[model samples]
Target: MSKNKKEKLNVVYSTNPNFSYEFEEEETPETLDPKNQLLYVLLDKKQRAGKEVTLIEGFIGSDEDLKDLGKLLKSKCGVGGTAKDGEIVIQGSFRDKVIELLTKEGYKTKRKGG
Candidate 1:
C-alpha cells in the first residue's frame, strides 16, 4: 500500500443538544407496593341509571378513608358511587381519567382487563 493512499482518520464525539436528541426518561415513580393486594382497574356498569362505573380494586387504605375518597370523587365528578369490598366504585367509565386523577393523589394503579 502506498503511503499517500493510507490516511489516518480522526473520530469526534459531541454533546450538542442540536446535534443529539433523546426521549425524555420517565420521572421516578411513586413508592407504592402493587403486590399482595393485586391492583386492578376495570370499567363496569351501575345497576341504576345504567351509568358506567370505574372500578378500582386491591387498594391498601383504611375503609373509612377509602369510602370518604370515593364519596368525594363522586361529588367532584357529579356522579354517584360507593366503596365496597376493598374497592372504590366510581360512576363513569373514566378509565384513563381516573388513573390520572388517582396517580396525582398518590395511588399506584394498574389497568386490568380490556
Candidate 2:
C-alpha cells in the first residue's frame, strides 16, 4: 500500500475488487455583498514583541475573495500582511485607515477593542 493510502483513516483494506475511496469535498461559502458584510477592525499587539497589528475580522466569503480583499488593503496601506482563517492581519496599526477604506468599499465596519 502507498503512503497516501495508509494515511487515510478507517480503511485498512478493501476486499472488493471494484471498491473505490470516496473523498469528501469542502464547500466554500458564497461571498456576501460588500454592503452586507459587517467587518470589525481592531488593533492587536499580542505575541509580536509589542508591535501592533491591525486585525480585520467577521468576513463572510470565499477564500479567494478574502485573499483579494487582503491584497487590496495591503496595497492601500503600503504594508505587509496575510489573510487566512477568515481574518486579515495588517502589519501595523492602521485601524482608522482600514475602517475608512472598508467604508469606501461599501462594507459596514465597526471599531473593535481599544
The sequence of per-residue lDDT tens digits that candidate 2 reaches over residues 1-114 is 244654555767899999877544558899999999999999999899999999999999999999999999999999999999999999998999999999999999999997
Question: Where does candidate 1 clash, by residue pair?
Answer: 52-92
The sequence of per-residue lDDT tens digits that candidate 1 reaches over residues 18-57 is 6632333434323234333445778876465776778988
What would the TM-score be for candidate 2 when compared with the true structure? 0.88
**What are the lDDT figures for the candidates, one per model?**
0.67, 0.93
| lDDT score of residue 77 within candidate 2 | 99
Candidate 2 error regions (>4 Å): 1-12
Q: On a 0 to 100 scale, what is the lDDT of residue 22 in model 2?
A: 58
The alpha-carbon deviation from the true structure for residue 75 of candidate 2, after best TM-score superposition, in angstroms, is 0.2
How many steric overlaps does candidate 2 have? Answer: 0
